[model samples]
Target: MNPPNSLNPALVALDSLPLVVSLAAPIGVAYSGGADSCALLLAAAERWPGQVRALHVHHGLQPAADDFVRVCESVCTGLTLPLQVLQVDARHGPGDSPEDAARRARYTALAAAARQLRLQAVLLGQHADDQVETLLLALSRGAGLPGLSAMAPRFERDGVTFYRPLLQTPAAALRDWLVRQQIAFVDDPSNSDERYTRNRIRARLLPALDSAFPRFRQTFARSARHAAQAQELLVEVAQEDLDRVGNPPAIQALQGLSAARQANVLRHWLLRAHQATPSTAQLAQLLGQIAACTTRGHQLHLKVGSGHITRAGAVLRYTPLGDKAG
Candidate 1:
């Protein structure tokens, strides 16, 4: 069999990502010294000399974390790029996913660093294969439109804009290009730890998808975009529906809407108004209960949010789980 690390002319000529021009004057790149981030940092620095700075988040989760930072510093120094490293506590809760905790902490630290640097946005190296893996993970978890939407190329977090310029390019091509250029980078060992769901998908499923469908990443990304668009439309309709239904949501007003529309409106209200996200099963059950409420005495109670959703006279009210019944 051919080697896994071999490269060809097609890979060499693979498409490059377009940068966001509106990200203010000194562009910040989330450089982890990995092949992907290294390639992105080099390209951005080359395109915008003396205007690109590398921001590295140091999550002290492993023994090699320091090594990663050292490599990143060396690369940035060689490129004559300013490098800033922010150390963070990435410890997860007892029931929390380690990867998720690290990701959230990394973004929080990056946003804080961006504020210190007065940068409005930072570039990330997430690529097409990463997008496909995200889509697959969402599907695996039986997620809704938002989860299937995967990652956006640009998004706002804590007043900082996060841009992923490489979402349209494949990961293999990025790594191959870095190798061909003889640029130095460090491989994070955790990436190959198949215990993580994303890692397993990346190591096993991606190759299978490549063989079964040569252009899977492109099509998968297209599907994610469609899902994102559809979700935005749903959110729009839900907003309109909520305006008509009114806050505290009159039961009579909600009953006038279709079951799907009722769920949409409730989801919008709970999340946007109260910061609560109900599961698909819970939402479906709540919709059924809403349809069954025929009399004033017909009490409805649903365990959702951080609280219980209950019908109080003509309107549905959400009370925190530990609060006394009113």
Candidate 2:
């Protein structure tokens, strides 16, 4: 039999990930000193050798965060790979989710660090369980098609390309491999805190799912892919409609389309052009106002996701939260 960590299940899974980058280009791995990321860092370093670098984001939210950096530094030193540690504030504002704020901060810091280092792409360690959890959370929130589509394997954010290669692999397989190889990894204490919905799902729901469905990971992933395909078609239609309706979307041209198309195109416009998303209530209200505006004297002003969508003459305009008064 082959030695542990040599052509192991976890390593094989990582190898199967269809990455699109030149072999000569450098890559950065988001190392969190956890089992999944540690396994990924080891596999990537083995494959790319000198071309792989570890990028660890220190959110400074907990006292143990400093130990994570020390472990990452030690591992990188042993592998002869460069390690970059970035300090970021992951605090949340009023009515904001702590998880979401930390995620945004981490991504922004990672992108900035990757750009500064001239890395071609960054790799993440999100696995199959995480994907399934995301889908469940979306379902619980009555999310739209985009939310149902879950995480994409490859995505661009802040001009940096990121890839999730382990989405097909299970978390247990990675942990098992790490144990067999006598590798060390720290478990984040927050992961066990049941105060979070995700942790509760991981602890209580996953075991039940494993017992009943057995193949929930593969099946759930298949559904997410189908949703993603449907979302892509919707985006294409929205693009065509926006082209006809105009950038600011002339109210007259927008009213010509069906209510469904109006909603689709408008949602696409706000997200693509203004980086804003409307809540369901906000979109429904905006749609009604657009339908009622037959007279030249009719006015419209509504709040939508950190911005206000108001009628400026014959077209709809988005003014950011700060510029609303102007």
Best model number under TM-score: 2
lDDT per residue (tens digit) for residues 138-193 in model 2: 99999999999999988999999998888878898888888888888889999999
Model 1: per-residue Cα lDDT at residue 313: 92
**Model 2 vs. true fold: TM:** 0.94
* Deviating ranges (above 4 Å) for candidate 2: 1-6, 324-326
Q: Stretches of candidate 1 above 4 Å error? A: 1-24, 322-326
For the record, the alpha-carbon RMSD of candidate 1 to the native fold, in angstroms, is 3.6
Clashes of each: 0, 0
lDDT (Cα) of model 2: 0.91
Clashing residue pairs, backbone N/CA/C < 3 A, model 1: none
lDDT per residue for candidate 1 within 227-313, as digits (tens), equals 999999999999999999999799999999999899999999999888899998899989989988999899998999688899999
lDDT scores of the candidates, listed in order: 0.86, 0.91
